[model samples]
Target: MSYLIYFAIIILIPIYAQMKVRSAYKKYSEVPSSTGMTGAQVARQILDEKGLYNVTVEETPGVLSDHYDPRSKTVRLSSNNFHGHSLAGTAVAAHEVGHAIQDQEAYAFLRLRHTLVPVASIGSNFSWILIMIGIFAGMANLLLLGIIFMAAAVVFQIVTLPVEFNASSRAMDQVVSLGIIRNDEERETKKVLDAAALTYVAAAAVAVLELVRLVLMYTGMTRSDD
Candidate 1:
């Protein structure tokens, strides 16, 4: 039952994200921001307002492929957003700009998440190899090591939650405070932001589940030895 639940969640989450984003886009295509702002325009407004002069918003190829690369000081958006003028594009644009705000404000979670990126990258990539070796060698201690690695990944995910959430929050606030859109448009924009937020949550859930799976497998191994 637990395995089934995990599998369902893993599969279901991406499905939900994709479907929701599509729906949001479809619904909002007819609804435009009052200022006639394209996503790139909104993003540029936010970046310039925040005094992040170094940050650049550019077009990338893909659907809903928007992200903030602090390293490159770039906010890359998909074709839909780069020139999109609907609720979907607006919300996505705001959310990515939200990240820039986080960067400028020195949001703690964002900072922590950035700091953990390297550790997480290393741990997530190599922990599985270590775990596989431990399992085959029947080394109980390796299970503990695996748990540590998985835990690191989990920590990164946990920290990511606030970083993402706060970004959305900042974005929504800006959209309202700046008079960027109407109240009706606000609802649609929020819908897009809300849906996008869930993807991060789903990612965190998967990370947690993977951690739990590792712990359980390691526990079973040690218990057998005992």
Candidate 2:
């Protein structure tokens, strides 16, 4: 029953969040911004205003595949977002620029998240395998190590929440201040960004729940051995 509950949480929340984001994006993508600026223009404008001349904006393939690559100091927007002159495009472009700004400012959470990337990557990839092997082999030490790895991934997820929220906040501020979106259009733009943020919140929730489930399982195994 508990496992069923975990499965439901792990599955349902992300599905709902994705649906919300796609619905919001699709609806707003059709509504052109009054400023008539493409997403690439918006991103470049914000980057230039912030004096982040080194950061470049480019279009990448796929829908809603926009992101900032801190390593490359580039904002990669999906083709739809890069060329579309819509509320959704403007908001997404600004959001990616927000991350570039975060990278420039050395935002604490962003820095922490970058630092955790390696550990989180390794943990996410290998933790489950280790846990399953440890469970079947009755190796307490190995099980503990898997739990520790999962904890690292959970920490990364928690750190990500702030990094994402701050980026959205920055994105909104930039669009408003730069007149990329008129005052009247602010609400719609915010809706699109908020929907995107929900996906991150859902991801974090899933990671935390998974960690909790593992810990509970580990505790049960240890108790059984005693």
Candidate 3:
């Protein structure tokens, strides 16, 4: 019952954050920007201003699928955001460009986060298998090893917050400085970015809670064996 309650609470956070972002996107997407710049155009201008000529902007299929590809030096935006001349679209586009800026500037946290990706991936993929094997064999050390692996995943999620928040902050600054949005429009764009940032926060929260649950379950299992 306790686990269920905790799960119910933690699960709702991401769901709510998703809904909030969607709602904000829908609302602002209808309101056209005064600058009339499509998302791709904004991305291009930001890259040019920052002298990121090597970076390329491309339109990708899917809703809210925008992301920065560090390996390819590319910023991919979803169809709607790529073509839409709305504050929401521009805000999201600038945010992705912010990641590119981070990559270009060698932002310390972003670099650290990138370095942990492989470790986190390995941990996520094999941690469960190791834990189950340990449980069946009653090996506490193996279970603890699994916990450490999952902990790496949790650390990755935690590191992700700074990268995301800094990106949004950069996006807002660029948007305002470039006159892409002004006054009331600036407020609306901030709203969009804020809602989007919540999604990352919720993701980290869920990951931490999941790690705690895993530890608790293993503790109970070890106690039963003893």
Higher-scoring candidate on TM-score, 1 or 2 = 2
Q: List the pairs of residues colliding in candidate 3.
A: none
Alpha-carbon lDDT of model 1: 0.83
Expressed as tens digits, the lDDT of each residue in 1-226 for candidate 1 is 9789888988898788778767777777667778889999989988887788899999999887789988888999898888978777888888998998888788888999999998888889878878888888988688678678868888998898888889889988988888777778888788877777777787888778778877888889878988
| Whole-model Cα lDDT of every candidate shown, in order | 0.83, 0.93, 0.93
User: Model 3, 87-157: lDDT tens per residue?
Assistant: 99999999999999999999999999999999999989998888888778888779889989989988999
lDDT of 2 at 122: 98
Give one clash count per candidate, in the order shown.
0, 0, 0
Winning candidate number (TM-score): 2
Ranking 2 against 3 by TM-score, winner: 2
- Give each model a TM-score: 0.90, 0.97, 0.94
Could you tell me how far off, in angstroms, the CA of residue 7 lies in candidate 2 after the best superposition?
0.9
User: On a 0 to 100 scale, what is the lDDT of residue 12 in model 3?
Assistant: 96
